[model samples]
Target: MRIAAITRDRPPHTKHTAEVVNANTVVSISFFAAFCPVSSRRFPAIGFERHSDEAKNKGNDFVAWNSLISSFASIGNASGAKNAFDAMPGWTIVSWNALLDAYARKGQQLRRMESLLDAMPEWNVVSWTIMLKAFTKEGQIDSAVAVFDSMQERSLISWTIFLQAYAARSGHLAQARNVFERMPQHDAVSCNVMLVAFAQAADPASAKRVFDSMRQWTDVSWISLLAAFARNGNLEGAKNTFDTSPFRNLLLSTAMLQAFAQSGHIDQAQAFFESMPEWDLVAWNTLLTAFAQAGDLYSALPVFRKMPVKDIVSWTSLLRACSRDPAAASIVFHSMPQRDIVAWTSILEIYSQAGELGAARSTFDRMPELDTICWTAMIFACSRSSAGEQALELYALMQMEGWNPNGVTCLNVLAACAHLGLVDRCQGFLGSMILDHGLSPGIEHISCAIDLLGRMGRLEQAEELLRAMPFSPDAAAIRALLSSSRTHRDVDRARRRARSSCSSLATIPLLSNAML
Candidate 1:
């Protein structure tokens, strides 16, 4: 048993059991003297029986119960886990934790999770931590925080989990700091969690403060801080973080390369890429994504061609970059080994952006699995290309295909109706937004509607919709109406709306290349 446990990587629990049996005189003798079964091999992984009925009956013995439950939980079968827990005539702390963990992981009902805790009759730090994690996953931040404060005993795990919850909520950096300040003990994991939270919350300075406060650090903490800097577009700061680290891992290197790429320092990014002794798929993807973002699709070509092995992400990145340049994108698309849905979607999006409606339609027809994104892209491209009739036809066909049109698809339909002077069609789309689809119109959706109304010379109705909007109008919508009014010879309405837009918001000067 001891050798098998060791081979199976359960040393801690096995050793603990050994100490208990060895400390007892009679139990140790009886344990060895009993009819002990011997296995043919030291460990069983590849050829192990997969829980046959006979094997399961034999596995009801005390030794295998915990392992069985753990194995089931690890595989993510909450139903099977509950069955195992119920089958056990007696329960242990380990078994309870496994069951509760399965529930938390599967995101079962919170009440169901609480029922498991209540049935325990006695609880420990592990049980509380699981509950905290469940609440955090469900976005019940207040409940998670309340549960933490109410715990008579809290550990490093509890503190780290709570801080993570705060960070997940937008603009809650201050809450994370408050939790970190109150923790009785701060370990590397705890510090690293806070750093990641602040970094992702768009506060690199807070992330840095937590990182600097750590008395000792791990590779995780180092990489977390570096990622924060990278996300904030602080290329020099990210580089400095990497240089200061005592140990650098693959993730840090990738982060630094991506940061440099985003900060428009392509040369620095290339330097880091060249310096790596060993490169993984992630490294290649990072470089490809960087070049794609810079609108430099040609640079990714050499990397794509010379890659030893390519995966979905690698192909997707190349295809995404190609979307910006039709000529280059066509070359990449043709050379693909086997195109996935993402590859086709990328090509469709490119044609949409480039106003190649015919090509987009061709790709859409060729796709074996035309998902919602593919349909939406095809329609969106038609709308963008000013082919209102084609876009409307595609929209109707999408519905006929039993695919529910989402907000993005609706927005495009509105754009098509507005551009084509189909006022009745525009009204029908708006009605669907509220009555059929049950989607609350966002600013972008409202903007499309306003553009539609403005184009029809209904300036008064457009202004009313702007005022009636739940959220404030964006600059683009206001400016579109104002500019359209000027073209329609409604100079007074145009000037008034323009002045209101300028005064109501800090409107940036419209770029000359903007589509409007």
Candidate 2:
């Protein structure tokens, strides 16, 4: 009998044929044995041993042993679960599966799971599925496919997971669709995955087709389709879908509100928000974002004040709305209950945009942690203020702090070098951007380099760079060269540049004429 079935009213001693047994003693031991593994507080080694002794005395069955293993596994104590499994005189496939799950949940133990799978006397479909899931979770898609192919039998869950693996990748939508079509059956879950995938890709037409084909619709199906329309900027389609939904859930209502906001229909968004029976934090934030997007700070402030509860996003949204007034933005920043990196970066941008270099630097220094965005913003601020030397210094410091320069970071750095007339440094930085960082230099980057070269009187090199540029040089590049030519009194080169500019751009004619 299970220890849990025992009652206090039962006799302390019960007669069993020729022998008398102590029922209360048995109950006490068995109860602790089953309960110790699941206790909130960790038991000492002696406590575990005592429980094991009790179970052994009672000739504990497989169910009790499996329960013990699972309880330990549930708490993420893989070693404890292993000890329980080893202590058992014998184990069933269920016991082995529990141990495998312990390892799987611990993660980064794929090889250990593989070894255990090999050692098992036998495994069922559950075993294979667990291994497949482990592979997928580890991002070993190719290996997961190999395992799936080897499975003699696959469950619906296995097939769905396989589809999701492909769907989650950006360029693998085709493969995901093929899997969906090949499945022996489809559920709302599988259909929703494909619908969301297409929606994220901004292919609303395909998403609609999938939605129509579904045998049944879930709330997620409605929301995904609504989101698809919003993503595509089809506000009218979003409204039609919302009106048609039989259930007007809070989640669906919030999605529709977002659709109106995304399309710049602030009045409609406000109206829709007012109409909702309930509002969640996400809904409130969405309404606030609408006013911020329209630069309607006056409208956003009242909504922010009215919100009963405010989170970091709520505070950040209000900070963004105050972008035009740096003093007001500073007030908001100081008033935030807690500030995350986004909040910190927003305040930094406000100061930098106002050309307040001293205040910007102070804010940058006060940041407890720095990310790539924060670093780039500070560097750009320096470059814009013509503090080229300081910007370069920060760039070097950023690299030392293990933040790699992104494309925007590279652009700002090159501009700094140009402002300081560091021609050789600018050329080297441009090369690093391409070869070291694996970034494709755009036209703006090339223009900065050409301007630097022109400023340094390396006209021959500047002209060579312009000719060899992969992108057609814009007016700015031509003007930089023309200005340099006139400064050096190179009439012949100025005339040649004017003729070339006239052929490419109509607007360039006026600037070229002025330069000549």
| lDDT, model 2 | 0.80
In the range 386-505, model 2's lDDT, one tens digit per residue, is 999999999999999999888889999999999888999999988998788888888889988888887788988988898989988898888787777767777677777677767656
Which 10-residue window of candidate 2 scores lowest in summed lDDT?
1-10
Q: In candidate 1, where is summed lDDT lowest over 10 consecutive residues?
A: 1-10
Please provide, for model 1 over 1-516, each residue's C-alpha lDDT reduced to its tens digit, 9 standing for 90 to 100. 111211121112221221121112322222132112323212333322365343367543533554555545544557777887676656656666667776775674577776676566355566677777778888877677667766766666677788878866777878878888988888777787788786786567888888888899888787788788878877678889989988867777777777788788887788889998778888888888777766676788788777888887787788777766798788878878878888889888998889888888888888889878888999999898888899999988988989888889888888889888887778778888899878877888888878878778788888888899888788878876775676577766765666677664433343221223
Off by over 4 Å in 1: 1-91, 99-186, 324-340, 365-372, 389-410, 422-451, 462-482, 491-516
Candidate 2: give the clashing pairs: none
